[model samples]
Target: MYFGKKNSEEPEIIMEDTIVYACGSADCNGWMRKDFASENYDCPMCGSQLVEEVRELPKIENEYNAFK
Candidate 1:
């Protein structure tokens, strides 16, 4: 799990089960993952170029039933 920097002005909400994939390239430490929406994200770690590679990842469901 990764902890983002906090802002004192806003309420703090903990995020769980946020899965992010690191770049397969050994030299590049870029990472890609879905955001709140199920859209493909580019590199969020190193801002490196991204390629569309189909991956079989576990389905993520909202435990709070927010989508339902």
Candidate 2:
């Protein structure tokens, strides 16, 4: 007996250590990667100040990844 075809599974989820600029507001839900954030250092969603935080987040999939 032999296997006809191997099942192709999705690529494993990749996690990465990334720095993010999160909203300082306690009641706001806003966060973004530091690299993609605005230079003004403000939350794009709630007009609040942003703070730096180190977090382990899922790898983001984007066109830019092709260059890496």
Candidate 3:
């Protein structure tokens, strides 16, 4: 039997204030990163209009932005 090693050095979670679009409907909890949002701010899950908001989220690359 092989024992797994415990790695103490882990990448730190880098949080940033990012723009996002969230569902306006109280019944829905759908949200998405602004960079990934479409021109029409509509919830793809519940067909609710989305509102822009700032949220603290982890840093990630917006692959869609790469083309621009």
Candidate 4:
């Protein structure tokens, strides 16, 4: 059984596949997830380097910059 949220009841089960990755930077507590088929996968909160390996989010000066 899946651990995360499930899709609504439907004739066909559409499981949304995602890849969770940790930030490549240090001293940051951020996490990110990207579509399994996506080519670009970066931290949503902070534009930091991300790798397939589990890591910690790098410390960022400003988190709002990402929104701008």
Clashing pairs in 1: none
Q: Rate the local accuracy (lDDT) of all candidates.
A: 0.53, 0.85, 0.93, 0.54
> lDDT by residue for model 2 over 1-68, one digit each (tens)?
98788778877889999999989999997999976765789888888999999999988866664685
Per-residue accuracy of model 4 over 1-68 as CA lDDT, tens digit each: 75997777666533444345666778665665432314556665676766664333333334554665
Worst 10 residues of 2 by lDDT: 59-68
TM-scores for all candidates: the values are 0.34, 0.71, 0.88, 0.35
Off by over 4 Å in 4: 1-19, 33-38, 54-68
Please tell me which predicted candidate would have the highest TM-score against the true structure: 3
Between candidates 1 and 4, the lDDT winner: 4
Displacement of residue 37 (Cα, Å) in model 1 is 7.5
Off by over 4 Å in 1: 1-26, 34-42, 62-68
Q: Which segments of candidate 2 are over 4 A away from where they belong?
A: 1-8, 61-68
Segments of candidate 3 deviating more than 4 angstroms: none
lDDT of 1 by residue, 1-68 (tens): 98998877874555555455555556786655443323444455565555544445555555555755
lDDT of 2: 0.85
Q: Which 10-residue span in candidate 4 carries the lowest summed lDDT?
A: 53-62
The per-candidate count of clashes, in order, stands at 0, 0, 0, 0
Tell me the tens digit of each residue's lDDT in model 3 across 12-31.
Answer: 99999999999999999999
